[model samples]
Target: MAGITGIGSGIDIDSIVKASVAAERAPKDAQLARLTTKTTTQITSLGSFKSALSEFQTAADGLNDASLFGTRKASSSDATRLTASAEKTALTGTYRVEVEQLASASKIASGSLTGDSNLAFASGGKLTIGLGADSFDVDVAAGATLKEVRDAINTQLNEKGISANIISDPANGTSQLVLSSNKTGAGNDLTLAASGADLQGLVTNRPAALSEAQNAKFKIDGLSLESATNAVSGAIEGVTFTLVKAEEGVSTTLTVGENTTAVKDSLKKFVDAYNKLITTTNSLTSFTKVGESGEPLTGALLGDSTVRNVLNGLRSELSNTAAGQGGDPFRALADLGITTQKDGKLAIDDTKLTAALEDNFDAVGSFITGDNGLMNRLSDRVDGYVKSGGVLEQRISGLQKTDADIKEQKADLETRVAAIQARLYSQYNAMDSLIGQLTRTSDSLGSALSNLPGVVRERS
Candidate 1:
């Protein structure tokens, strides 16, 4: 057999064809990828929605309410409402009045002291003493012991007010409890002349009853608002702005925001995305390549007029006029410098667009933000495509599976072809070697005939 071997067999035309077919199904590989389109739309819608909410929030954060969380501290100036008993309700407003009795106005201490020169009990520990008509007990220290006995006497001592306190006694090493009352108002005025240890300078002076003031003040969006009492409500509709702290000035600078650059950038993005979608869609339309063999997308979606109609509608849809509460706010995308062309695509004029935002921000907001906005619509379409049975998701999945299958089959076919090539080369080498041996054998036979030439020459 010849030593020569086969090279590639024939060109693997089947491999090429199979590869092409698999590639043709490549779009199906993107089915799942397409499903995420809805998520993108969802994110867009959520952003727009949040933007809308921020607008209202800005208008609702100005008023202040004091009574709800804070309390006006009580002072000595609180108005006095005389009570016949301790169950008396608190008085309203501030005042300066002398109290006849702390616990009751009806029950007044009567009679005068006899044995002891002063009205103070023994020292300031625990004293069991007898009063006008009833025996009483008193304990005096500094503050609590001072008010505790007074409270007990005011509520129980003939229902009259009783006040007492212990004075620091340097002589006895123990504090003395001083007890006194203005049982005879304007006359007794309550006197405390401690006996061997009387409250000489302590019980002589006293403070008059007082009341505190209660009122609230606040503003909304820089407008002065008032509350009848400390508790305020209905200052602003839809949202109540509480004035936590009273503002001294009227013209408060509300530093909202002036970042039109980002908004302008968003406009450009919308335009760019719109055009890209249109261009992609157009490639599938009657727009054909000059010498291409086939149209990549030549069916209802690609070449169909109906498809163009839908696309043309999108120009209107994206730039659709939106009405605002203030009138023609979202009248047209051009209003926001988002202009539509005859080619059914949109473009943004960055400078003019940003200027428009400064002049009238509500219009731009109405288009992409409010009820039935472009973001919401686009998101809905995207959402539909991303779910389990969506078109893009299914198409991408199909393409991917198809590409995978083709790749697998191509690998298998290459292996089998390599095996076949090895076998064919083996057979071709055998035939080439047999041809070489036959040629050598014929040459040896011719040489033997040449040696018998001398006998023929003698006969001649």
Candidate 2:
């Protein structure tokens, strides 16, 4: 309508309306843009801070374990024969082991058969599978083929760890149904019994043991020990040996010792992670220096008390001395050569730390992983911030809500501005119509005056 509004009035109504609308929109647009930028920056900064906290927590977790300081390194002279692993409780010593036999699962093959094409198993007949003193019966449905009966047993009694399979023995030019036990032990022998003639001939009186169930026979330091499985435990305190195969005459030496390198590596990771968090917090909370022609730039979280509190809390926890250690032997991170730098970052003296760990390994473990240790305290603090309803989480949630509010405000502004534009157009159209009517009225009066002969009428 504004496009045709200025035609009668000889004034550009469209331009006037556009200018008015733009003036009305400028302030709100600028305000919304500023708010959006601030909210987005806060979200990104909080995300970085949270990620740094999580990473530092992970590093702290690595050192939180007492066993990390007492980690045992296990090695087998011949890995092909056997492999070993040791835990923190493992003693540092050398052990000679010889594996005589590997524990085997019990397997039985039925007498030679032409094929598993069909079987005349009697209806409602039952097959009993025995493992040690435990046994379960599988019902043989009427007119079940050998394959169908195998499937029924597998589907029904599979919970008992019994598996049935039809294996083709080309070497013997015959096919046989095989049943095996899932467990490995001499006591876990597989025995089968069938009540029906069809099943009895096929499963009962299992032809000469295909492979007898045997226990893993091995000797540790010349002391004979038997295990139900290849993985033998309790032979050595906190150490488990896995027997690969029998090496009758060969003996493998297994040595267990403290893994000092691993401990030092974990400590260094903790230090590095702590320093990273310090750097991130500094950036988030600190301000940039004034430029040559502008004022100083504030950080995303500048003037935020939460940021300051978090940093201060972490520093306090890190600097505190752990309790439960009677003496100052290794009670603080400083004693382990992890000192606080002037910039609030942790700096590790590798040589001093290594010497400290080597000299008092157990005391160091007790100090860092004790009930009131640095890691435990710090972990608890960080958990509060990142866990449900924590300070940081709540802050982020509030910021998001503010963002949502801003979005709604912008939408409302757009609606109001559109309505204003429509009103301006309507006003201009009414003004144009009034001006056109006035012009026509003046022309009619001039014509009437000219027709009275007092005024001359010009020729067209």
lDDT for every model? 0.41, 0.82
- Record all residue pairs in model 2 with backbone atoms less than 3 Å apart, i.e. clashing: none
Model 2's TM-score against the true structure = 0.70
lDDT of 1 by residue, 1-460 (tens): 1232322333343444446544644564454345444434333433332233232222111101111111122222222221111101222223222221122111222222222223343344433433334345544433333335445445554344445444444554433344554242222233222222322222324222111122344444444444433223343221222223332442222112333444555555555655655555554443445456764433223444434444454455555554334555555667666687888667677777767776765455545553365555544434434345654445545645655665676566557656655555455545545655666677777667656756444354
lDDT of 2 by residue, 198-275 (tens): 666666445886777889998888888889999988889999889997978679999987777788888888988888
Candidate 1: regions farther than 4 A off: 1-272, 275-313, 319-337, 347-367, 386-389, 451-460
Q: Where does candidate 2 stray beyond 4 Å? A: 1-4, 54-77, 85-92, 105-210, 255-299, 302-309, 312-359, 380-431, 454-460
Each candidate's clash count? 34, 0
